[model samples]
Target: MSTLNFRRNTNNFVSGSYDKLIIIWQVYSNNQWYCQQKLNGHSNWILCLLLNNNDDLIISESEDNTIKFWIKQNQWVCQQTITYHTGIVFSLSLNDQQSKVISFSDDYQILLDRKWNVIQKIKVDKYGLRLCFINDNQFIFQSFCQEQMQIYEMDNKTKQYRRMNEITIKCGSNFDHYSFPQQYVKSKCLLVNKNGKSVNLMRKKENGDFIIEKSIEFDDQRIYGQLGQDREYLITWDNKSKEIQIRKCKER
Candidate 1:
């Protein structure tokens, strides 16, 4: 599987694979999981997937340079396909209000509204492996192999987004892998970012500044993990260790 998203308030989850398939799985009361649906639409490897707050909508990006919207009717179906990107869509992020979406690709960073219409398209100097929305009007983008992550904010007057600042991060080498992703915890004001061989943990302050609290280094570049919903643990698996490790959040 390339990417997966668990639906909130439900025992179901969705996964996208490099084989160009999206599978929805449901857990039974007996604790066994079964495939509920298989969505076939993308022509290339699926890179990212996002489930909305209600779990009725799904946003997916692929190496075919297309972004697809799968909506739930009587069953899950592809309601729309966006072909605006010229390169592989690497990542997808939904804002807190679920009103906007941002996608990062090799070519451009495109923003779309709830209606799935293009709001803004930004061409960055360096293409990134991941980008995420911290809030409704703000987002962070990490350029490939760079030690700095760029911040963008929406202008209240023009209602357009512009690059506001950059946060320095740890990148031990020029090499990195795809799909580790950047995750932000709103409740804890925390960000878990994977760049090169390190996972940089940062705290976002109310003043819009970020403080790097810790950077967990690994011997290998392929690290995969997710933060627990309760903001108490981080579970990770890396090629170097070949084991699933869980780390508890410590109060500082």
Candidate 2:
């Protein structure tokens, strides 16, 4: 596989092979990686890719102004192709439980079901950069310049969607768009960059509002700058000392 843009899901890794091909890799329990299947349909660069919870469905967005879905069985095959986006698809999210998937491009939200059928198309002030399912009925969205994260409600039975409200995720600071895998804890969520230097923990209230639970700044030398496994430890790697320093809490 060509080392281009690569994105990871829970069980598999989606990577672009060269500029035109995308392949799905499965990591086994013994820590070995194997190319389970290859998807060969794009004519341009693959911008983003992801796998659903079941690890059987692959969603890829490309600069070709298209989104393609593939199934992982004996062979990787194109299950459906969505060519309605006017611009390049930037991001996508899938809620397997609700059997709904949503994609975002320049200024639209393309909602599709499990069968890869277009259900609705709605316009927002800015494109929805990333999405997180709060539950079966609701999800949260963050944008490029938007200070508040938007909450969207979906009908349980009909899967109809509405922009219910907005909540302040970052008050004084500008929103970060590059980092994903936003961690959800209770009603609160943790947002961090890939480098892990800065971390923000925010909480959502019952009224669909958000507040900053904590904002932490770490040393520049710390290789791993965020909270550790159980949120009970902070790890920092020191190159000069050649040691890993861990700041952990005392056991209760």
Q: Write down the lDDT of every candidate, Cα atoms only.
A: 0.88, 0.60
lDDT of 1 by residue, 1-252 (tens): 988888987888999998999999999989999999999999998988999889999999999999999999999999999888888888888899887888877775555556788878887888679888899888999888799999999899998889999989998978888858899989899999999998999999888899999999999989899897777999899998999999999978
lDDT of 2 at 198: 35
Candidate 2's TM-score: 0.67
Candidate achieving the largest lDDT = 1
Clashing pairs in 2: none
What number of clashing residue pairs does each candidate have, in the order they appear? 0, 0
Candidate 2 lDDT over residue span 1-252, tens digit each: 322223333565678754678976778999998887667898777766766656677788777889898886688799888888888676666663737667777646655544678877767777555565666676666665455677788766776888888765432333333323343434224433222333445656677556665544433323333355466665544333556666654432
Best by TM-score: 1
Q: Which stretches of candidate 2 lie over 4 Å from their true place?
A: 1-12, 26-36, 96-98, 110-114, 155-159, 171-199, 204-209, 216-252
* Cα RMSD (angstroms) for every candidate in the order listed: 1.2, 6.1
